[model samples]
Structure formats: structure tokens, C-alpha cells
Target: MPSATLRQPPSIPKWGRPKQTTKKLDWAEIKVIDLSTYDEPNGKQKLAEELRDAVHHTGFFSVTGTGLTQEEIERQYDIGQAYFDLPLEEKGDPKYRCDFAKGNYFGYRAANEKKIMGTAVLDNVESLNIPKFIPSNSHEPFPHFLHPFRPEIESFSRRSLDIASKIFTLFSLILELPETYFSDQHRYDDASEDHLRYMMYHPRPAADDAKVQNTWSRAHTDFGSLTLLWSQDVAGLQLKTPAGEWKYVPPVPNGIICNVGDTLSFWSAGYFKSTIHRVIRPPEDQAHIHRLGLFYFVRPGNEVDIKPVASPLLRRLGLVGEDAEEREPVRGLEYVRERVKDYHDHGDYADKKGKKFKVRNLEIEDEAS
Candidate 1:
């Protein structure tokens, strides 16, 4: 009898964390919230009080005790690095690429494909956005190499959202609304633009960076409700301070950096900030390293209206008018989809410094300086 054929197990990629930069840099003093206290009595309220100043002032903070193990986080980084290491032909296959024209972001975005700020220097950031694993998104395309890791990816994605929901509860408490107010609008099983992203920024020549004022990614606010960035030590991310100065967002060991986004700010009637942030070339010592990032962006449900909520605090502060509910409504999906198209369906990252992007009554300045 012929010998039976043998099958080989699929290979898993290996990745190690990059060493921290030895050079001292100007780091932003962002507050860190410990989620371990979340389940204790009055824990949510206490955490909300701690987070109040950070959200109201800087719109940026970090979280720890999130129940995500170091090993689990590293596994995600490994998967991201491996996917980015594949040949362009395989990673950038048309079937798996982002459909920016139609406002679909659930796929790969190849690096250096377009010029930045109208300069000859190309954009060096590449990313893969994985949609929620719910059945509705089953039709979305993902790179074949990632198929074997689906179960773990799905688990990570769901857990990230769960952590976000706890944060949402804190936000609601701060706003004097029902604890579930924000979370209800962002159900994981519901259809939304939420994504688990793996992003990489390749270093460019110093001269090329200068052409765009050393901007690796231009200044802009995130479009969703909340953004969770897993801490990494590459040292290029910066946030524009309220006083108009830029400061590096320091890495929090084993913590996740969280930021409020446009929708969240809108929902809170501007009580919660949606700060502008950007990526610049790393400090000279770390400039040659590729900055890898893992993130989960939470968006409101597709059919959910993004109208400012009727908060008691807003009413007391006169931030929301008696006729606030009478204003035209902007659905969550509509705004995000349009924002995605306006920002990405372009040949170049031209400077839109004073332009305004409006949807219904909601509008934001295109501060991509």
C-alpha cells in the first residue's frame, strides 16, 4: 500500500518587542485609570471621577488592570508584524484591499501609495482593519494568512469592546446619565464601523520628513466614539494640547491608551473633548524603527442617531438648548462613512487647513495642517 501523505502544521509568526528609546523626550502627562476596581462597590463612580479631568481637558488617558495579559497582547503584535511582512502581491491583493471610494475600511491599506500634504514624499503608514466577527460582516475580505488566527482575533476583538464598555459606563456616570446610555448605542453585535486595526509606520528619510514638516501622519481627530491604542514604545505619537503645543504621548507599560473621538464629543455636547493628534518622525535615536500599533475603534450602531444626549449636566450648564432634540439628526453610520470617504478617497493628503466637513448639523474643521 502507498504511504499515507503527511500534513504539516501551519506556521505561526514570531515577534519580539522593540527596545525603548534611550533618548529622553517630552512626554505628555496623561492620566492612567485602573480598571481592576470596576466591579467593586462604587468603583465605576470613583473611576469616573478620576477620568473626568482627563476627558474634559486633554481627551487622552491610559488604562491598566484591563485583564488583558502581556502574552495575549504580544500575540497580537506578532500577528500584525507577520501580516505586514508578507509580499505586497499577497498582502495588497485587490480582493483584500480597502474600498475607500465606497467608504469601506475593513481591509488592507498599503503603504507609500499616496503623497502626503501634496509633497513628493509618500505616506508611509500601512494598516489592516478587521471588522467585528459577527455574521453580518462574514462577507468582508481578510488576508488568507490570517485565517488560522481567526478564533484568537475574534476573542481579542470582543474583549477590547468589553473593556471599552466599562469605560463608557464611566463616561455616562460623569455625564449624569444612565450607566448603560453610551454602551447601549455601541452594542458589539450590532452593525457598526468598529474595527480592530493593526497599523505600521515605516521610517522615511529625514529630508523627506522635513518636506511635510516632519509629519508622518497629519493632525486630525479620530472619527469614531472612542479609540483604544495598545501601548508601544516607538515614540512618535503626539497630541495637540489645549494651549496649542504638541507633546509626545508617553507609553504606559502594559496599558492601553484611550482617547475620545468626534462622535463622543458630539454626543456629550462638547463637554467631552475630541482632541487633535498626529504622528511625527520619532526622535533621532528611534527614527529608524518601524512603529507598530494595535487598536480597537468603537463606533455607534449604524442606525443610531448621533444627536447630543439630553444630559442633566448639559442642561444645567446650558450646553444643550431646550430645542436641542428638535435639530436634524445625523445617523452614526452616515457620518463615519462620509468622514472616511472624505479623508481617504483621495490621490494625495492635501492640506485642508480651513475646510469644514459637515453632515446635517454636525460639522468639524479639517485641521490637517
Candidate 2:
């Protein structure tokens, strides 16, 4: 396999962020907590408590196993490395087809194609997204490249799905909901039970300004419920710290990074934040080569409504106004479409000015950095 070391990034000026700032979350301190021991019976309980605080306070954290083994996580990483080692031409066979409503599913996305929110600069990275278990009877045209990858990637998917369920139970418990409330919804076939995965391979930026990779997924929030991520040890992933600084998420041994998405944020009545994050290649001077990550996104079914549930926290946060507004649930497909549009057009509202927008309302365009 060709090593990522063979393809280092070109230099670019770091803008958007200040070289030093007070709003930044300290990666060093977070890592100490992230790698702390939680092996005893009460460890799980303590871990959950700390996790809730981290999610609320920092919007990001390094999570140790809820159930996955280090060996198991490594296996998935190996699978991704093997796939990335494939010839560019070989991987391009299905040829990056995208629908407005499905995000980047079934395609090869170049950098800068998907514009960053509130930034003029494009990113520097390339990626592929593969969905699991395409309903055989469904009419949506599943891409062909996805076929060869299923056998190799299915293991990764299953692992993610298992973890998602486990995490959901914990999240449900934290929400004070019945243990079965979240898991029981998966029984129906038409439930829009999607397990989406992202395999991102960030090549070094080109020396020429015209060909930079989209550094990382721009400053955006996930569309669905929650996300589980296994990021490379390389430093690049940054989240908005409570004080407004961008803190790097350092890798923890066998740890999986997880976060809530917009829908969950809405459902939780703002108790859990759907934090905004972005990816950028480490400075060219850094020793790391390619930065890769495998993301497992747990989302709600297509038809599920999204609104603020009544909670003391919700009322305190002013999420529930005098009039309880029930935001219409966005169809999973429509949410993806707006995302593609925004990726191409750069988040300018497509609809008329002053028009009302609904949940999952995205305006980013699809363009490679």
C-alpha cells in the first residue's frame, strides 16, 4: 500500500482562527481526562457523568470503549487503509454521483467542492461515503462502487451499528427515557434507520492555490441524531469550545469520539448541543502524513418529527417560547439535498429572502476545495 507519507500537503495561510486565543479548548487537559482510568464498576457511571459534562461544556471529547475492543477498532482502520490503497482509477469506477437530498452518499467528493460556512477559503481533502444494507426493494439507485466495498466495509458498518445502539441506550438513560424508547423504534422496516459512514482521506494540499483539498468537513453540524468517529492520531479535528476557541481533539488509545447532531439537539430541547466542527490538515511542517477518519452517524428515521420537548432545562434555556412551536420534521432526503446545494453554492439561501425555513434547512453547496 502506498503510504500517506508519500503525499504531504502544501502550505496555506491559517486564517479564520487567531494564532492564540482565550476561546480555545485546551487539547492537553482534555486528553488527560480522556485517557483517565475508568475500569471499575462505577467507572462506567463516572464515565457517563463526565461524558455528559464534556458534551455540554466542551462539545467534544475522547471516549473509551462502551463495548468495542482496541483490536476491533484497529480492524476497521485497517479496512479503510486497504481501501484507500486501491488505485485512484479503481476507486473512481462508480464515479461520484450525488443527489441533493442524500448528502455525499455514493460519490467521490473533491476538496473545496463543499464550501465552508462563513469562509471564503476552500478545504483540502477528498472523501467517500458508503451506506450500509441498501434496501433491496428500494428504488433509489445505489452506486456500483458501493458493491465491491460492501464486503470489506460491512464489518466496519456492523461495528458502528452495534456501538450506536449501545450509545443510544446510554443517551436514553441520560435523558431519563425508558431503556427501550430509543431501541424499539428500529423494529420497523420503513423506519429510515440509516447507518451512514464516512471514510475521509486527506491528501496534502497542492502547491498551486487552485488545487487544495477540502481540509475537513467545513464548519457544519451533523444532520441526524448522533455520530461516532474514530479519527486518525493526526491533529486536525477542531471543535468550538464553550469560550469560543477551537481546540484540537487529540486521539486517545482505542477511543471513539462522539457528538450529538442537530436533530438530537432539537429533540433534547437544547440540553445537548449540536456543536459545529471543521477539519484542517495539520501544518505542512508537522510530521503526520494523511489524516483519515471513519465516521458512524446515527440519525433519526425520515418521517420522525423534530421539536423541542418540555424540560426544565429547555424552559431555562429559552428553547421553548411562550408558544410551543412544533418544527416540522425534515425528510432525510430533503435535508441531504439542501446540504448538496449549500456545498455547491456556499450556504446562500436558495429560497427567496425573508422566507421561512424549516428544520435541517441547509444551504451549503457541493464543491471540492
Measured by lDDT, the strongest candidate is: 1
Q: TM-score, each model? A: 0.96, 0.70
Cα RMSD, model 1: 3.9
lDDT for 52 in candidate 1 is 97
CA lDDT of every candidate:
0.91, 0.52
Best by TM-score: 1
lDDT per residue, candidate 1, 20-52, as tens digits?
888888889999999999999999999999999
Candidate 2 TM-score, C-alpha based: 0.70
Give the per-residue lDDT digits (tens) of candidate 2, residues 203-245.
5444432232434454556666778787456566777666666
Off by over 4 Å in 2: 1-48, 94-96, 101-104, 111-123, 134-152, 184-198, 205-216, 284-288, 310-327, 344-369
